[model samples]
Target chain A: MTTLYHQPLDTASRCVRLTLSEYGISTHLEVEKLWERRRAFLLLNPAASVPVLKTDDDLVLVGAGPISAYLSESREDRGAPLMPVDLAARAEVRRLMDWALVLMEHDVTGVLTHEKALKRSIPADHGGGAPDTAAMRISRDNLTWHLDYLDHLLSTRDWLAGERISLADLAFAAAVSSLDYLGEIAWAERSACKLWYARVKSRPSFTPLLEERVSGVIPPAHYDDPDF
Target chain B: MTTLYHQPLDTASRCVRLTLSEYGISTHLEVEKLWERRRAFLLLNPAASVPVLKTDDDLVLVGAGPISAYLSESREDRGAPLMPVDLAARAEVRRLMDWALVLMEHDVTGVLTHEKALKRSIPADHGGGAPDTAAMRISRDNLTWHLDYLDHLLSTRDWLAGERISLADLAFAAAVSSLDYLGEIAWAERSACKLWYARVKSRPSFTPLLEERVSGVIPPAHYDDPDF
Candidate 1:
């Protein structure tokens, strides 16, 4: 009975989806058109953002951060815990999660999504027009800087946070997945990051994201290929 | 043995400082001039952000979110938890924390901080200039909207998230305190929000924040007045 209000290309929604799937918690997924700012959605979340989760009894969780925390709290030894139990380890996981989901989204994925995909979806009157090339160029500059950091991390650790796959990996996978959908990632230059991304995408939970197709935007050829 | 790397007017830094004080955890606070992008700071956190907590054992916790979560987890049986023990309640608290620290920050506090405070501190070449009037105006519009939401929430709940004080209130207080210091808030129009601010600022943990001063910028006349 848990229902998730999400969107195809939204990184937060994708992160929640992966978290849900990882916990083996299947819920009805509803695509919320955030641009419309629907009143019902506004009632649920005044922020008018995506990835709002309503539990079976109607308790609502707004924002990816909250929903992720709730799902992790309720996970209860299911599969590998996305967040480690050791407090310090958990802090590390949370740190990378914040980096990928918040910082990366703000600098890289969110900007690319808005300029490349979202602008194409909305009408010109609503401040949507041709993509802002300057913004995209800046995003790429940031993307390279972030990828360098991610590459550095991957070189030292088995995964983003530590040895086993954690929510940090999933969050980065979600953000990168959306960018991949828009054909934004330059995989060849970043072999280490690419390998790590491949491992993350190979997860069964990432299948839906790989298969997702936004009408006007076609993904890069290697986007859905786990080996690539 | 513990130390906090922070900047006086930084919202995230203020939030963490308040949380640490509330939990009765004292740390030697060090002012990190973020504009300088200190190499030593970068070694600790590549993100080069403030509010990085270095633990007694040399564990560096970056970002306010992780620091808050880590403190809460270690706060077993401490003074009324800043985050509730109940999972659902924790989710609501997280939601509001995200609202205040992230959403409200991106739209309001962060904007004003950059335009007014941060800009004044940095060199003109470092993207600093006379305060962007258009950006300030937009931030004010967003600030009003956020205050309205806070007013509505306060009207129903005893605190921001629920019946008790939590990190959500502290986070909001941090953001608003910075704005108030800049003399940006229109206190008369938003009576409910003002009252809530008054309550939050009245907490003992808020003393350091009120006493904080930057070299050139001056806080409003009523900035430190608890009853005002």
Candidate 2:
């Protein structure tokens, strides 16, 4: 059986989980508090990042991009293809996935993880310092620009990215859901984006993700509510 | 004929150039000053990113991942095959590529681009605005960590990542080269990484990339020297 190492509140982890479920692959989910830096988890992924998938062949895949690519090839028939077959369409999907994962989540999720999660999970030997206010401020400023870009993209497409649902939508939704849980989204300013979120939240694969709870961090009331 | 939309000094653009050359593909290079943000260029890429490829079939492939994927599938011979046929090895290669493009570049090249290139290239639109000191500072702090990680990885391997010289090496060298041009690498502190870079710099495909010069920026004297 395939095993997935992840944390409950990690958006990238949730994205992988949703993809796996969509493909009808039953994975042995291992919840890892990565901040603890357990030796076993480090052995699997030296990068010490979440969402590491250990395949039945004993190959450990790190990062969502690789995981999605590998699974897409392995389980083509079970789910809507995460990447298109046509070269141009595939390129668009990959670009949008990068935009969501690298551009938006890099800063926005970094802020939320450090500000909220890291404080509670940092090990004693790791010199648990307070979240850097300067980094948070920069992240906050960057968020507005990114959100506006998403709003523009959502205005024209039913999904956050390409035609029909792709990994890009799952990636963006996972990040946005995490931010929403932290009450970080400027909802009124991103009305179009919010509407798109409604569509993603309505999916069956997203149900398990929405119900996930992280100890000491209760999600906002609207997080699990599909109508929100 | 294949047409590449690029800027001389752009590292990501250079990565694509090296890959194309290695694959023995002759391309018509159209230099686009990404800093200029022309209307035509924006239409091609709303994210205003560089390294977009237009193929003979009129397919516009954006970003290094998609472009590399397209090229790898299009050709059977020429250069070292960057991606592997084995599913496990392929996953590892893709993971390393993502790490280089998303994680490392986000800190290293992004800082140089925003702090130096953007200010110089978009001065009229960014008139009198203070440089993003926080972003620069975080980048400076985070860079050493990445360098250390690379040094550790390259200690027993010839490449920055994986057994073969894959896209991961190209992506990493491109990001590091951009920073090295800005005098950002602490060579003495990362001897292993420097040694690995010395090997990467010697490839024939890397020659044209190293020789490239941007109008306003002067590269380090050692930038084009393979022995350096």
Candidate 3:
């Protein structure tokens, strides 16, 4: 048995969830309030971040990158690999993974999520309050730049990384899903990305994520609508 | 022949350089003025980031994470794997890799490098200007927090991740080396971390990197001293 410590709306956690479900791996989910930085969670992951995976034998994997790689290496027999077999193709997938999990999060998803959703939910003393409009404006601007880039990529390729759906697609989907939940994405202007996201949403792995929500924050009306 | 497009002061580039040398792989290095966002470089890596590795066959692998993974997978026979063979150990190594590549870069290295090093070199029109003292203060404070954490880790483990030197050590050494060159680290306050860094610096792979200098940035007197 495996247990995953995560936050429902955390993009990294969501990416892990999508990867787990895509591979048909069964695992228990435990939600962590990242801001609280619980001692127990910190012991499991010194980074005090979510999306930590602990195996039944007590092996612990922290962060989406480590956990994702662990799953690929240890559980390949359970399902197909989430990355391509070709060396160059695999590098492309990993490159986009960095773009989504690190770069995009740094500029857009993490900023918007913290400003809008996270701030609204947490206590004022614990770094929560009214969303900074200036930060939100910058985040939205970054999102627009990223969405345009994604549209350019999706217009050319069937998936974010390449020919077959891979972890890169899941990582990007997680980012886009969280933004769409916060209603931060302007999808109508990015039809190519929208079409690709719709295709991703129709996957069985994404269904449970669509149903997942953060407390005290409501998503857009069309958030879970695959056709939307 | 492998050709690496890198910026000398770039932490990611340093990691790749160290890794390639550690693996006894000979490669050609080309300097990239990252701020310029050269069109040819952009064509090689759409993200326009450095530490891109182009194989003799013309496959381009971008970013430290993807490029490192590719080298480890493809060139394992050339050297001992920088990560341990144990699955759990590999996860630990990767966790530290993320800590170095993503978290530390976001919090400390990238900010300081941009402010003190990159901005000094790039023209004013290309987003370079006076160093933001406010940002530098925050980065230095963050560096202190990270150094305390590293000191705590090095007090117990022989390396950042575990008993033996791994890619994790190299990744962190890359970050710390860059900061050390910028004279941003207060080494006297963190003895354990300093000791561990000295050990890493003694490695043959680290020597060439110590010799590498950015165009306009001069390192401190103790910057390249393995015994300092």
| Candidate closest to the true structure, highest lDDT | 1
Best-matching candidate per TM-score: 1
lDDT of 2 by residue, B79-116 (tens): 33876666677787788777777677666676666676
* RMSD to true structure for each model, in Å: 1.3, 3.8, 1.8
- lDDT digits (tens) for residues A1-228 of candidate 3: 989998777789999999989777899999888789888888888778988988888888898888888878777566546877777888888888889998899889998888878888788999999989998888888887888889889888999888889999999999999999998877778889989999999999999999977888889888999999
Model number 2 iRMSD: 1.2
Give the per-residue lDDT of model 3 (tens digit) for B142-214. 8887888888888889888888888899999999999999998888888898889999999899999888777
Score chain A of each prediction against the true chain A by TM-score and list the results: 0.96, 0.91, 0.96
Q: Rank the candidates by lDDT, best first.
A: 1, 3, 2
When sorted by TM-score, best at the front, the candidate numbers are 1, 3, 2
Clashing pairs in 3: none
Interface RMSD of each: 0.8, 1.2, 0.9
Q: Per-candidate TM vs. native?
A: 0.98, 0.83, 0.95
Residues A1-228, model 1: lDDT tens digits = 999999888888999999999888889999887878899999999999888999998999998888888888877556448888888998999998888888999999999999998888887877788999999999989998998999999999989999888888888889888988888888879899888888888989989889888878888888889998
- Tens digits of per-residue lDDT, candidate 1, B57-138, equal 9999998889999999887657458888888999988988889888998999998988888888889877877999998899
Query: Candidate 1 DockQ category?
Result: high
* Model 3: fraction of the reference interface contacts it also forms: 0.98
- lDDT for model 3, on a 0 to 1 scale? 0.88
Model 2 TM-score (B-chain only): 0.89
For model 1, the stretches where C-alpha displacement exceeds 4 angstroms are A77-80
